[model samples]
Target: MKTVTNISDLRQQVKDWRQQGLKIAFVPTMGNLHAGHISLVEEAHKHADKIVASIFVNPMQFGENEDIDSYPRTMDNDKRQLIEAGTDLLFTPTPEIIYPKGLAKQSYVEVPNVSDGYCGESRPGHFRGVATVVCKLFNLVQPDVACFGLKDYQQVQVIQTMVDDLSMPIDIVPVPTVREASGLALSSRNGYLSAEEKAIAPALQQNLQWLAQEIQYSRKTSPDHSPDFIGLAKKAAAAIDATGMKTDYIHVSHAHTLQPASEDDKELVILAAAQCGKARLIDNLQLSLA
Candidate 1:
């Protein structure tokens, strides 16, 4: 795959592709290549004629105490994986290339409401960094379609809201979360887990699955009664903590708006974040009551 680091060179290549009438698909990621990330590129291959994947460990998206400096950067491996996954072009822009005026002076994008709770609440200014950098990448890549993993459900929602509100012509595709056979959702942070912690990691997904099943069973058996979502979330969080992980937040919300799930809401999602050793892991499950 052709790798370009500058904006002008990247745009020129995209322009050439546009002139050829080739549809483009984009996948933006931090530089830790894994099976989960490759899955995104594979999904992109189905939607467009050429795939454009970017690896910019966005400093804007990371918080003050977050792992920006220590975030994994496996460039040689990442390039090999992308080429194997059929990525046509790789855009590896430096932070300066992305934010010429510096982050303090850079223009930012914020999608209100959806970016308020869950991870947003846990990490202030996180979504602001996410929206702003994603907005910049969307502008630079200008692909017809972009694929994002549903493992980061709120992030997908925030980006979707941003694109719709801004009238950007890019289609946002939500790909399913790829997991290990043990049920652990793959994340770069997973590398931080000790062997003991790795064994406990699958409990996060298990708790979410259990919560989904409980909600489903409650709806089926007690059609007239509203399920106690807040209580269920608390129970799940407690169960996760019982497994030696510290719960950050476990919430049930409307799938679309991300507001607290009400009795009348048919489409719902359960999101959870927990600290397992040095790694902070997040996972979610969506339910369609309709």
Candidate 2:
């Protein structure tokens, strides 16, 4: 319920909580919160004694020509939602506070290999911004556990890789993607969709689900061809295109490394990003053939 914009104030409050032997959970997000984001805070409660949610529309994570300026900022509504979701503290810092030395001079973090494909390929330098800001938040909050939504599947893997490689002491927990009755993955960006576009948007998830089922069914039947993954991806892309949305990338990859998957790979995930109307949407589903 309490909101502090300064880093020192945020840390001091956390320090007091630490003295009380309270385990902290952190959820970092941009301002425009929805059920998807609140779900993260709700999930955080099961793992820690207190939850600290941050709202900073990270400029570092956005690319040139991206919606940096127009990205929605609903702080009043976001605070209300976070408080209602049982978040203990809200850290809402300005860009200057986060990057005191200025963005150009600030140190950055990058997780190679895991961040190299999928969204990484579509938006260059995106993961570097994500890893850097997340690292900053981790250092500032020093929580015992952090919760991230699995809607950004590759992002989850990237952060997991960063934490394991850097030996950061925070446990990374991934909450499942929250969706609508219509099967659309709930996202802050969903706000950008027009009514007409909204109706068609759920097709993205539908296509991904259809592909997952096809892959699973094919493997179960012991098909000779092993289900052509590449062909399925292309067909999925074409399906999205038919819906009048532009497909960014639809890829099937090894769930852990985000690399192209082979039939022998037991764990796989299908991830896709597409633009519909003004909203840029992403969704994924994980499968285990093992």
Candidate 3:
């Protein structure tokens, strides 16, 4: 695999590869390569002749209080994994190379409406930071297809909206979430979990499970699937509390819109976020009352 560390080098390399009639696929990630990221790379390899995976832990997307400096940087090990995964080009660029002017003064992109809720509601300007950097990467790599993990499900939606709105040609492909057998979502933060936290991390998944189970339990007794959305939200909140998590917010909402749905809307998602020890995690489960 070619390890590219500069803008011009990647541009020239991509140009040469395109000249050889190779189709390009890109997977943009922050460096903490795990099975989740490798799964995306594996998906890219299935279709594209060349896969260019970037490892830029974008500073723009991180908040002032967020774990930017503390974010895991396992580059030496990451490179070894990408090589094993059949990645063709590894674009490892600096912040200045990406943002040029840096984040505060840089031009940013935002996807409207859909970016208003879920993680977006809590992390103000997060999607703008995400959308901006992703837009920049799309221009830099100019891949025919860009692969992302479904682990960041809402993020994939926001990015797709941005691509369509701006007429970016890259197709956004969503790969499923890679999980530990414990049912905890595989994330870089998982590394920071204490043994006690790790033992209970599956509670994040179980909270989602509880939300689905409660909604169905209520439905079966009512003979009507339309349980109160606010009540269901409370039930979700209670389930999260039962997990010993400090609550963020919980909702049964339209999976696509992420707007809180009326009770009558049987198709929804149980989205929850909470703090577990030093780490904050989120998980979601789809619930369709039939």
Candidate 4:
């Protein structure tokens, strides 16, 4: 509906909304919205009286050689989807407004231990960028609650840990990963897949599915050595490699701390990353292999 690009204008509007006794819900996105993003808006609408969603293509969250320039930015399409999904206000700010002093000059937020594994290992500073921008958004909107999709499971873990550690009063609600009928996790990056890469894309999901199945079979057939966690990790890697993936990292970790699982009955997160041509993809499935 209404788009407010300036921070002061958005703040004045939200102050008015709060005076009316409306509870606010905020959803921060990097534009290029899809069904997965819409899914977050739906959850926010259900929980808060006033919904404020911001479309910011953050510069801080990107790494050297990463797709900051190539990353999708479909603002017109994104606005229509949010309005149709019942988002009340669109706070689309320029990078200058978000990081007035510039990214290099802005303060950052961090969460320990939880950021030690998974994507954190390869991307380096990626999560810090994420935490910083998210913290900025939180301070900007000051919503009673915020919604994030579980598709970015590690990100959710990081933000949840940050809120708890700092005693920030905002409630963080997480929605499950939304997928296409073919099983690929819906992402803005999916737009980068080539014709051949698109055909090969579902294998990311297939690899995670195979990891789940392998754990099941390993438990049934060889109950004596039923839960060989390391073997499951290797099998997941082999599946990704066999699928023509240029690997990033495949990890099996505890669902909470994200530390690699070493014993039985521990919840496991099977996360894998790889590139299909120039497009990078990630997918994960949580299972009880122990």
Candidate 5:
């Protein structure tokens, strides 16, 4: 795969591909690739003739005390993996290239409502940084389609909402979360987990699955009654905390809006985030009441 670091060169390559009438798919990431990221590239292959993957660690997304400096960068392995995954173009832009005017001067994008709670609440200005950078990349790559992982459930919602509100023509495809055999959803942050924390990590997914089952059971057994989502969430959070991990939030929300779920909402998602050693792990399970 050819790697282009500058915006002009990247745009020229995409322009050349467009002249040939080739469709392109994009997968944007913050380096430290695992199997989960590769899965996104694999999904991109199904959507377009050429795949453009970008690795830019945006400082705008990280909060104060959220050490952007320590975030892992494994470009050698990342390049090898992208090549194997059939990525046709890799855009590795420096911070200056991405934010020429600096973040304070950079124009930003924010999708409201869906970007309001969960990770949005936990990490202030996170989605603004996300939406802004993604908008910038979308303009630079101008892919026919973009792929994102559902492990970042709220993020997908935010981007989708942004695309719709802005009326961008690109299709936003969400790939499923890739996980270890123990059921822990794969994340770049997972690398920070100590061996013991790794053992305790899958509890996040376990509790989510259990909560989903309970929600389904309640719907089936008591068709006329609300399932008490708040209570179910509390139980799941307590269970996760019992595993010695600090629960950030365990919420049952309407899958689409990421708002608190109501009994009438057929499509639901259970989203959670927790502190596991040095890593902050997030996971979700989607279910249908209908």
Candidate 6:
């Protein structure tokens, strides 16, 4: 597998592949590769002839007090895993290459309302950074299809909205979230957890599952009733807090619009974020009542 750090080099590689009549699939990620990331590459292979993965930790996505400094790099190890996963090309660019004018001077893209709650509420301007960098990557790779994990559920919705609104031609494919046996979603930030914190982490996933069950049961038992979702969210937050983790937010929203789920909404998604030890983790589950 070839790794290119410059846009020109990446373009040439992609051009050559296109000339050969091969379609490209792209997976954009920050380094510190894990099984979940590899699964994204694996899913990419199913959609196109070649897969190109990029590893650049976007600084714009980090909040003022967030741990951008401590975010894991793990480039050497990441390369090994990507090559093992059968990645065709890897793009590893510096920040200057990605944003030559610096973030302050660089133009950004935002999807507005879709990015305003859940993780967006907790980390202001975070999705703007994500939308901008993803737009840049989409332009750079010019892939036939791009793959993203459902692990970042809201992120998937935001990007989907961006593509639809901007009329981007590439297909956005979502792979299921890869999880540990204990149910914690696989994340690069998972490396930050201590042993004790790791044990407490799975509760995030369990509680989300519990919430899903409650929502499903409510739909069945009280067909005409609208369960007080806000009150249920508080109870869910308390359940998570009881696990010794600090809750960020736990709310139910429409699966597609990310607005508060209503009585008539057949598709709903429950999303959560919390701080466990030094790591701030997020997870969500989508459900369709009808």
TM-score for each of the candidates: 0.99, 0.97, 0.94, 0.94, 0.99, 0.98
lDDT of each candidate versus the true structure: 0.94, 0.92, 0.85, 0.85, 0.95, 0.93
| Model 4 C-alpha lDDT per residue in residues 60-107, reported as the tens digit of each score | 878787878877778899999999999999999988988889887889
Candidate 5 RMSD computed on C-alpha atoms after optimal superposition onto the true structure = 0.6
* Candidate 2 residue pairs in clash (backbone atoms < 3 Å): none
Please provide, for model 1 over 138-177, each residue's C-alpha lDDT reduced to its tens digit, 9 standing for 90 to 100. 9999999999999999999999999999999999999999
Over all chains combined, what TM-score does candidate 1 have?
0.99
Ranking, TM-score, top scorer first: 5, 1, 6, 2, 4, 3
lDDT by residue (1-290, candidate 6, tens digit) is: 99999999999999999999999999999999899999999999999999999999999999998988888879999999999999999999999999999999999999989999889988999999999999999999999999999999999999999999999999999999999999999998888899999999999989888888888888899989986788888888999999999999998999999999999999999989999998999999898889
RMSD of each: 0.7, 1.1, 1.8, 1.7, 0.6, 0.8
lDDT of 2 by residue, 150-238 (tens): 99999999999999999999999999999999999999889889999999999899999888988888888985556789999999999
The TM-score of predicted model 6 comes to 0.98
- Best by lDDT, which number? 5
Number of clashes found in candidate 3: 0
For model 5, residues 1-290, the per-residue Cα lDDT tens digits are 99999988998999999999999999999999999999999999999999999999999999997999999999999999999999999999999999999998999999999999899999999999999999999999999999999999999999999999999999999999999999999999988999999999999999999999999999999999989999989999999999999999999999998889987999999999999988999999999988
Q: Which of 5 and 6 is ahead in lDDT?
A: 5
Clash counts per candidate, in order, are 0, 0, 0, 1, 0, 0
Q: What is the lDDT of residue 142 in candidate 4?
A: 90
Candidate 5 regions with alpha-carbon error over 4 angstroms: none
Score candidate 2 by lDDT.
0.92
Question: Clash pairs of candidate 3?
Answer: none
